[model samples]
Target: MSLPSPSPFPPPSPSAAFRPPRLLALAGPTAAGKTDASLALAREFDAEIVSVDSALVYRGMDIGTAKPTAQQLAAVPHHLVDIRDPAQPYSAAEFVADATIRVAQIQARGRLALLVGGTMLYFKALFDGLDEMPAADPDVRARLEREAADRGWPALHAELAAVDPRTAARLAPHDSQRIQRALEVYRSAGRPLSEFQQGRPGRGLRPAALLSLEPGNRGWLHERIARRFDAMLQAGFLDEVRALRARGDLHPGLPSMRCVGYRQAWEALDAGWTPAMLRERGIAATRQLAKRQLTWLRSMERRTVACDGPDPVGDLLQAAREVLR
Candidate 1:
């Protein structure tokens, strides 16, 4: 007893006193009100927000990306917003790494972490880890980029479809990043990119509470897309694009400039298209974006809280409570 006495440390706490790390993923199509709902949930749970949007990472991409206002940022701390320049390259792999670290840090500080955005690929990459693939080859990439420039991305997409129909079928023709990468992998690895992904389940970032916001009515969703694009125009979206163009460093081929509204805006400015025409094209692109997001949502294997009604915030809160309990 004397030998064991005078231990420097107190007795270990009961296991019941510990709470395992928990992450809330608020995912939805664009303009589906994820921003508002996520902010509400974050406030309720003392969580910090980590944006999952690809476009929101770029600086000077505010209006088109619908980045959080300064006021909103002040109320609830957000990570990974405006961390990259429009010309910089960021990928799902990088996002997974950075977000994983952020999640751990937030938990260490005795706070919850909420990943909020419309970028499904980012969500998928974080939750399900990426497969091993060939590294980027600048020479191969440059050649593909040149081919795209001369023959158009649709032509390159057709080439991909011929080689790897599985991946190509899921990717849009205008999805330059995926298209280029798939072709590069093919050129370097001598196999289809999809083949590498076949039958190999991702390691994933462990369990998370998933919530998806989708409009019950397709028509309603389309209307929301249209209205949101119109609001962007009213908010001087062209001026924002013009400011980026004024930088003289940004270009249409760059990932940042290719963001939905920004791409359409650039084409309109270059073609001298009328405002109404540009507006129509922007809205249509946004609708397509929503469609792609919904398709991904539909493919989820895990059970999620699907909030299709008007009260998304309420739905999210209720579902989160159940998951935490």
Candidate 2:
């Protein structure tokens, strides 16, 4: 895909010796045009794009994740994409550490740091401090997986509800990966996950000047999500998943496989789901992901721009100016 020309969008006037180590974030739900807007803002401000997306970090998962095209990546310097193999796990805390270093490095080079993507959890961890939560214990996770095998994930989610109602309330009962993690934390730390989430500042924007693209019309976003998923399918999303499966090192349980479209495609290939089923389920799952993303965005403090109509990047540019000015 061709990158949008920044010529039409005039650059902002340089201020008198601006603050150093500056950061800006362009956040929105999936399929809401974040990449295009991010590219424009990064170019106008001479910013390096530091992707805040969780899935984009993993290598070889591009087609489904709507990752920036090669041409686009060549056009703008993007940090944190394709940094890890699909077999490895990336946490929000890890993202914070990597992004912090990259942001400083970009500023050191006399460029702006633009954090951009749809991963709300990573954004939260970067802007707001994370509590000293226990690291993921493999033994605990293995135990939870075994118990889930016997009693099923819904049963485990029920157990989690018993310990961490606050966390449980936000999660769906069937979300196995998160259910397993929450239970693993509770079992290993002897404390509820909710407790760790508490006492940390709620919804912060630490050094990143925040701008959000929120859809004013939910239907418009839904349509966009559906159309985008279909486009991904046509563009060989299944082939990407097939390649990952052939690696034999990855599984549906891994964080990389658990990404929205990849998860569905994996199951479809395993269970012989029809193309119609894959498209239907993939589109539905993407819409749900977008819904969860919008929910996360609403909780944070941000300068909002409507993403529905034309000139959203223009609006986002204006919002960034407001935050930076």
Candidate 3:
């Protein structure tokens, strides 16, 4: 991984009135109304949105990623959405560089920048900065891919356990992509990723406030996830997956392919599963994702302002105003 260079431009003048850009990060699980709430707050503050989503960055991945529509995007200036091709790899370090430039531009124009999405790793990269880890070698990855094909992910996971037992312990046995990457990184860099993360210096992208949209009812959010998966199917999510698969770039074990809906879609394509089965599996995967997201939010040091009602837009805007003040 490449370490980000320091900003080339000089810092803003040190006038007492000079306000560094205020980033209001709206974060939460999938189907949490983040897009709706962020748009509302953008309108209220005349702010531009810089997406913090990992999946939404890919082009032609709109419906499944729950990306905002073109009309919605036209309503407000949004950055970092639909910015990369499906085959392109986007790292958190790259996001920080792109978003930092956009945020600075927004500040230069005297407008607020609202950072919104569910990708926690991106947020951490922006605030804490990334370690100067080694670059990935395609040859190494190809070799690992061949190994994984010959001997399944479980065997690879066992290999990782021997090399990086601490990392393997935390990851699920089926999390092949992460496990593979971890092992690859350790072998390539000759350093444990866990060890590199310890004692890193800070580069502050800390927001004036970090708010998560926690709906009052967990069941309501779960129902929302189920409904969203159904909507994705109606919107041709499987067709999108088929197109991606046709590219011969669909690495089933890769993180991108293993995303909630994509995993189920891949299973459907491979097993000749029915549409209903696909839908059921996708919904279950989304619920699991939501559960993990909720667990992450709970672990945050920031106290999220919970919204009690269905329409969280009003509460989000009010919270933004309070934070800005």
Candidate 4:
């Protein structure tokens, strides 16, 4: 995959003293109120938005993604949303390339680039430079596919364990896609995928501040996740999935269909699941997504804002102004 070049202009360092911020990342779990907080920051700083979401890239996935409404989107210029059809894949590498351009353009216009979303991998790839790895080898992939057909993905996962234990440990035994890629890298390059992942974290796009919104109490977040999923159901999330399904081109394996709510809804439609069952499954999947996102948030350097509190956006504004002078 192609990479974006190093930025010509240096970004502001988070540790530097009071001045205008060139960029800010307002990241949090799903339904943590990042939208309002990011908008507040953007308007205050005369910034434009660059969404850091995986799902928001798709054209027909608005409600399930909790994408900004017409009014919210019209209020400020946004980039990177509705740029891809649901059938096409949008990789983290692509996000880095796209976001790099958007940030440069925003700054060129004397506007801050306010990144907002829970898609941690995109954020990581953009801020920390991506490491170079071997490209996909069709022959190698075909051989691996034949091997998986004969022995199953778990067995292949065991082979990956022998070569790249770190990558294997994180992957489930049946995670065929990631397992295939890791093994393909090992066989093609004779180097473990973990080696590439660790070799370079990438050049930092030093923001004026990196604000992480998380609740001190995990339960509070869980409650919010539950309520939000219920609201989605009430707001015609199932009918949205039905519309996608009616298209007949999408499938469960596609990344777009595999998103939290859409995944459950697709299975429900296929199996004729009761609404209760669909709701339960969707809520559970969303909670797991939030948990994984929180784990990623903790690894990066950022100021923590308690999003569960009554005045999360207000708290975020205070924290932002402190560094974004």
Per-prediction tally of clashes: 0, 0, 1, 2
Put down candidate 1 lDDT per residue, 154-254, tens digits, no spaces.
99999999999988887899888779989999999999987765432345654445677766678877877788888889999999999999999888878
> Considering lDDT, where higher is better, how would the candidates rank from best to worst?
2, 4, 1, 3
Which candidate has the top score in TM-score? Answer: 2
Q: How close is candidate 3 to the true structure, as a TM-score?
A: 0.86
RMSD of 3: 5.9
Full-model lDDT for every candidate: 0.81, 0.83, 0.77, 0.82
What is the C-alpha lDDT profile of model 2 across 1-325, one tens digit per residue? 1122222112344782465436777889999999999999988889999999989999998999999999999999999999999999988778878998998898889888898999887877776657778998988888888898999989988999999998887777777888888888888899988776654553343544567788888999999888888889889999989999999888888999999999999999999999999999989888878888888888776656777767788878876665566
Sliding window of 10 residues with minimal summed lDDT for model 1: 1-10
Pairs with backbone N, CA or C atoms under 3 Å apart (clashes), candidate 3? 1-134
Give candidates' CA RMSD values in order. 8.8, 5.6, 5.9, 5.7
**Error in Å for residue 318 of model 2:** 1.5
Error of 3 at 176 (Å): 2.3
Runs off by more than 4 Å, candidate 2: 1-21, 202-205
lDDT of 3 by residue, 1-325 (tens): 1111232223445783357546668888899888888889899888999999888888878788998999999999999998887777787778989999999898788898898988876776776677877777778888888988899888888888888887776556666667777877898998876564432334647566677787668888888888888888888999999998998976676557767688778889999999889888888778777776676666554536675474567767776676566
Candidate 4, 1-325: lDDT as tens digits = 0121233335546675445768878889988888888888888888899999999999989889999998999998989999999998787778888998999999999888998899987787777766777877879988998999999989999999999998887666766667888998999999998776652443757666668888777899888888888988899999999999899899876778878799889889889999999989888878877877888787766667777777888788887777566
Against the true structure, what is each candidate's TM-score? 0.89, 0.90, 0.86, 0.85
TM-score of structure candidate 1: 0.89
Which stretches of model 4 miss by more than 4 angstroms?
1-19, 135-162, 168-190, 199-202
